[model samples]
Target chain A: MSRVPLTRKGFDAMRVSVIHTADDIVREHIVNKSVVMFDILRASSTISTALANGCQEVIPVVEVDEALAIASRLPEDTCILGGERSAVKLPGFHLGNSPLEYTPEVVAHKTVILTTTNGTKAIRRAAGEDGVVLIGSLLNYSAVAHKLFAAEQDILLACAGTRGKFSLEDTFAAGLVVAELVQLWYSRHNAAPEESCSPQADPVPIYAEEVPVLPENGLLLEDAAVAALRLAEAYRHKPLRALYDALHGQKLAQMGLSIDLNFCAQLNLYDVVPVYREGKITCL
Target chain B: MSRVPLTRKGFDAMRVSVIHTADDIVREHIVNKSVVMFDILRASSTISTALANGCQEVIPVVEVDEALAIASRLPEDTCILGGERSAVKLPGFHLGNSPLEYTPEVVAHKTVILTTTNGTKAIRRAAGEDGVVLIGSLLNYSAVAHKLFAAEQDILLACAGTRGKFSLEDTFAAGLVVAELVQLWYSRHNAAPEESCSPQADPVPIYAEEVPVLPENGLLLEDAAVAALRLAEAYRHKPLRALYDALHGQKLAQMGLSIDLNFCAQLNLYDVVPVYREGKITCL
Candidate 1:
């Protein structure tokens, strides 16, 4: 193929790209980037709840057999096999991927052997200690944003989309995370000094375009991230509406799981960021 | 992967998805779908300009050598070898992808054998007689959207991004097309009957979520398409700013091609839609 290389690689700004699904991720794009993976509907919400509720650790495996094998190695009483295949609790599993199911009494002091169709596989595939993998969802987006801001590396929001297609809820959650990061970045680095901001600095600009410019060392949101931020802005007044906008949410609502939707849509309810490093997810 | 299928497949409505870059397109998603391939930086814009300015026919080839070979077969005086590699005019080629250069005086009534880094290849690769492929850009998006609405098939906006990564201009143009299609849909299909519009129809709803539901037989913008639409909405007041916001546009500006940028960003200056079918691009 006769083509030029993407020139953005030489750019020095802190960049963010929202990979719509795990299937769409390019390894090179995320190889050295800090990742915040979102499976907003359930898996991520479940992980956050388990961690906040005192679970010792969450082992996100890619396959059910792997989870079962890992559980088999641990003492039966010390491990809880918890996950869903096609949104149903697998045979002999204690939980069905609902955040409510990971209550303190049920998950406390136990190791969660988890696998889901999308989220767990994404977690297993994208995990690398060098990338600072963090599990994100509405329940922990602000905490995730704080980590992303402090890390100051190229960022990727890997959305564990439903069944290898773009999932609205995951993208919406990603947009929320991006919005928070932008807010945090601006708060940490205030506008130019009043003297430099004076109109006399430059009577003329390069282009008379109204688009916001990324200041030096400021974050550069890619096109996908910018789109996601717009989405987040549109749903700022009612974040839960975003969850309900997805067909996955409608399916869950039809299956009498609106309770879980309500539970997962609460932003920053738990001040926890689950860091996935060296194969285990524990609170940051 | 243990997963349920994406439930939206069985949906009874018009659906749209925006594939961010040529490399990201899934063949299955576009198998029987009508596609508007956009390389908004230049290729599509150039094609629109050529067709609008009275070119006989435009044949898109994937390689410069293929173009040269094809031009060799045609009478030299009748065929115009046109295209660019890395935004530079190829050796012996007549054009370097700037819309302004394809004046009627130069290309009128001549066959254009064109190849470019992104858009032309996407056109050659995605063209099928049955899918109703069309070359689209900011230049002809409305006309393309008109064809899309009239065709009544699943729609795709395939962005021929800068290299293998997403291009901001292409996605923004896609968002504009989506907005147009939406406006046309709403204009053609007015609200439900006045009787059905009454408040007493149902005092309760399925979920208390504030989402604009897709009316029967209406368009279902997928998550990516939805994001694109949001982007279009963000720049609705200052459409041209979207072009300058892209790194590609900045590169072009640095190379003194802002004339092409301004030419491409005008929403619908050319009242032409170039249909790519049977390996040739001609007016619809």
Candidate 2:
């Protein structure tokens, strides 16, 4: 199959959809688009932070036994086992699913074998697809959006909901990313004429194909995408309050993991974009 | 199993969770709560309006053949077959899944055998649960919330998403319902002081057991619930824009069913609360 690069002319054809849970993902939706997976309460945030802190790579497995089985085969000193079940550290693992735990000293230059209740399952579901799969969260919101805008592919924001149910934090994080992409697309379209093309100066078809294909009226926004952007804007003022009051976050806090809430709430704390391909997540 | 009437004392235990898709519902979540199903784009809205318009009852079947089988057994003059597939009316059916077609003259004193792509399946999923099942939408938002508040039971907003993926309009409608419930709960708590027991009034513990048992901070808002409320508020001002721009709504409009859009976009158009019990939906 031949691939056609998405030019500015295809901007109108560009679309954004949200898969609110792993169970809702359809193979057709991920076939030829860039998929952004968000498990904002911890997993995506942790992986992005680990990559930013110089972790070599993070392997996400769905089960504890699978994580342990893979960890045993790797060099003992090079790989550290990590993950959580029911908001606590799994027995005999080096670390739990906490963003703060994936610090520079602990994960620097090490391969982290990680798994969690929901995030790892969503990652595995998106693996082996024909397109790129990237992990995102509040921690790397802008960086992920920047990458998606540059790629110019139709975007699918896949939220790893809590236990196959719709989760607030993940969906909010997805909305934040969509809002950023919309803003970037609009700014570029507005600046296109001032940069190189003027109606009076340009007689040739210079950058004609580069012009956007938005409708004569304006950009077309999907209702779901618009709702998501509105949701992000509604809760934009208090990032920490939004997380702290989320169902999953409150559950984590009740389990004595309030520190994780503080860490996940930090917006754009990491400059890294974690790209998941071929069963592993690495910094892009 | 014995049932406990949800009193003011049980308010803290009266949790509200949003199941963003039919697939996300677990048997446990519906075991002892009032489940309000929202498929705001069409089905629930249609059914609610039908009941409000004096339709005798609505029988929701998962398959068209089943609908046909049931219609064959009933009086042809009294029962009307209605449904849709892929947003179009099924061939040979008496009516498609459009609210406007269910006007008083056509459907009054008649039983409508109805099925749709997503809404009926969700109704079936919650059919045998031990708790109450009610149909809700923007058309009957206040009525549904009023019933739930009076029941004082735990609430679950079940969104019949588009083919199991989260649908924005449904979630937004769910959020609207949640926001109303929260406001009602708070207002009742504040008004308790002036109702029965006062600072120096008689204290015979008349409403002592009825006092709410909220945590030290008062009401505990789940993150998913809060997100839904915010989403509803975000699109509250532009209800028609919210409906017309929704992904499902756009698809319907593209199919030349813009009439459905205009009908479903009417907020609180009907005062009826459609109750689904024993495999049928009827006005409460």
Candidate 3:
């Protein structure tokens, strides 16, 4: 059941909605929609990282036992266990939920089975029988949007917030995805980006009206999307700085994992757009 | 059922959380917390308007029959049965949910027993076992913030979004409340409004960093609160225009209720802060 039933009935418009946390998944219907899942503080970033580094595939599961079970079925040398509970590596797991741990030297050609406190659960929950689910992060935001641009489907920015509460970094990353999508649309229509629209430009009031849509390509921003986009506009120029300033960023910094923030914050570091379908994530 | 379990353990910190919709209330605990509920498009606005119009207590209920049953027990002349379902005045009810309908001429000296689609459920849900509940709207945002500022409690902005989805106007109004609270904090310490800080000024980046904290007056903004504040900053100068441009605003205009938008969008029109306690709402 769609929370906003009638408004979504007619248009095949790219009506984007941002679900603030994994717990909010129950309030939304994922059927026939395209979901871009973000856990930018790590999970989605890690998937983007691992996939770009030539990991064969990533299997995200909600439970540690499930990840272990999936891994046990694969050849030991061909598969790796990765993820975290309480932001620490699970006992007997091969790696924690950090993008830095998934470098090419480490995960090349290996299937990574992952479980985490929020991200994996978020990815699993955001999936549906008749929808497309793509992993997104600041690292591959434009790539993710490129894959979704021509699809006439509802888009849900599935944010894997920290423990069911809203995560600033995840939503911030989702906003980046939303902005990238809008910028792509503008470019497709032969509209040049305003001087103030550059990611490196100083912050300015980038009005939503800048998104002038053609009738056939109607893109609508739901309330959450509009809010996310505004918040994203504020920190687009200094995304890494913005991410480092998030509460989780501060905590991770304190945890001696400051390396991960720099890893996750690099824009378009990976052009690989990972798609999660049939319980596995793989990318070109 | 606190969504952020461990972090809230030690705070009397006035940590403000913005629940984007009424459905999100389930993930938060209201006990020992003060909630400022906003259904700014009309319900809470109607409450603020009615009370400001010199009405007696406003009784909010979720069901039509309960409103009717309560009104039946009161002196017929002393209670006004007012509410709406699906944005239309309920048959047999004396008034609809529009703030314009609760003029001083109609609601004066009468207890309004209200039953609305989302607003009552939000107000009741935000109330806790041992905390304060206040109805909030753009019409009385500052008054509500003033009441909460010195309370030294965790404050939740319980936004009654449409159905189980997010509402732009409600959160926008909630943002106004958040900004007002911050501005109040600034003013308390004799910090004059920055050149760009006035609500009537052009849109500018009102940095969250502007809110410096003293040891005793520490106010922390949660993720949703931060997002809300950014949204508020974008529209503080033209809130009425912003409200009128919201999806619900256009819907109301289409429904011939455009006049209500002007009424609800008026910031701090009523200095009266209505408190919801023990099943009734009243103000001095």
Estimated TM-score for each candidate: 0.86, 0.80, 0.84
lDDT of candidate 3 over B1-284, digit per residue (tens)? 23221133444446778888777676345655767888987889999999999998999998999998998899998989999998999999999998888989999999999998888888877775333578888888888888777665678888888868888889888888778877876677676655323221121122222221222445666767767876788677767655653566656755766567766777888899888877899993
- For each candidate in turn, the interface RMSD (Å) is 7.2, 14.7, 11.7
Query: Least accurate stretch of 10 residues (summed lDDT) in model 2 chain B?
Result: B196-205
Q: Please tell me which model should have the higher TM-score, number 2 or number 3.
A: 3
Candidate 1 residue pairs that clash: none
The numbered model that scores best in TM-score is 1
Estimate the overall C-alpha local distance difference test score of candidate 3. 0.75
> Model 3: which residue pairs collide?
none
In candidate 1 the C-alpha lDDT for residue A191 amounts to: 45
The reply for model 3, stretches above 4 Å from the true place, is A1-12, A129-131, A187-217, B1-12, B128-131, B186-217
Ranking by TM-score: 1, 3, 2
Ranking by DockQ: 1, 2, 3
Give Cα distance to truth, residue A119, candidate 2, Å: 3.1
Name the runs in model 1 displaced over 4 angstroms.
A1-12, A128-132, A192-215, B1-12, B128-131, B192-215
State each model's CA lDDT, in order: 0.76, 0.74, 0.75
lDDT of 1 by residue, A1-284 (tens): 11111122443577888887887666676776778889998999999999999999999998888988998899999988898877888998988899899999999999999988778888865664334478999998888888777776788888888888778788888888888877776676674423211111121133343233334666776766766776787666566666666667767765777778878888889999998877899998
Tally clashing residue pairs in candidate 3: 0
Tens digit of per-residue lDDT, candidate 1, span B172-275: 88888888878777677764423211111121133354333344676777767766776777666555667765767766765766677777878888889998
